[model samples]
Target: MKIKKAFPPKIHNPETVNFNEPPAKLLERLYSSHMPRSYKKVVNGKEFFSKLDPNIAYQKCPKLKELLDKMLNLAKKSQSTAT
Candidate 1:
């Protein structure tokens, strides 16, 4: 007769699973709400198109940066654990 080894059951982490919102919607909202948009402006009798500056948004939105950092850290942790 052969003996079998049993493994422990998997644990569920609520932080890892989000059922309320999809990832695409979260990302879309993140960018749309926090990101700056380019627009046309008239300055000194000259018309110029302003370039979109990401720093402007970053400077204004600390929570956005925090969320992005947390997301990046989570992604890195998941990748490392997956392998």
Candidate 2:
């Protein structure tokens, strides 16, 4: 007589199944973008455009720079008040 070997069960997670897929840009309105349409960019703590290029969006996006500057200034102001 031979004994059967036991094995652990595999977990089922729908999200992990698609882990190889590209990251989504569901919230384009707030994201910064750099393109030929950079002039149309809006970052007055308001909105942005979708389908932005990665290099430009993360690096040389003029609108993004403005938004980040505004955010940094706000942060500094809040920190000073807290102190």
Best by TM-score: 1
Off by over 4 Å in 1: 1-55
Clashing pairs in 1: none
RMSD of 1: 23.1
| CA lDDT, candidate 2, residue 3 | 8
| TM-score list, all predictions | 0.33, 0.32
lDDT of each residue in 1-83, candidate 2, tens digit only? 01001111432432233344422321222122422232222552133244435455535556666787799899999999999
Residue 8 displacement (Å), model 2: 46
Highest lDDT scorer: 1
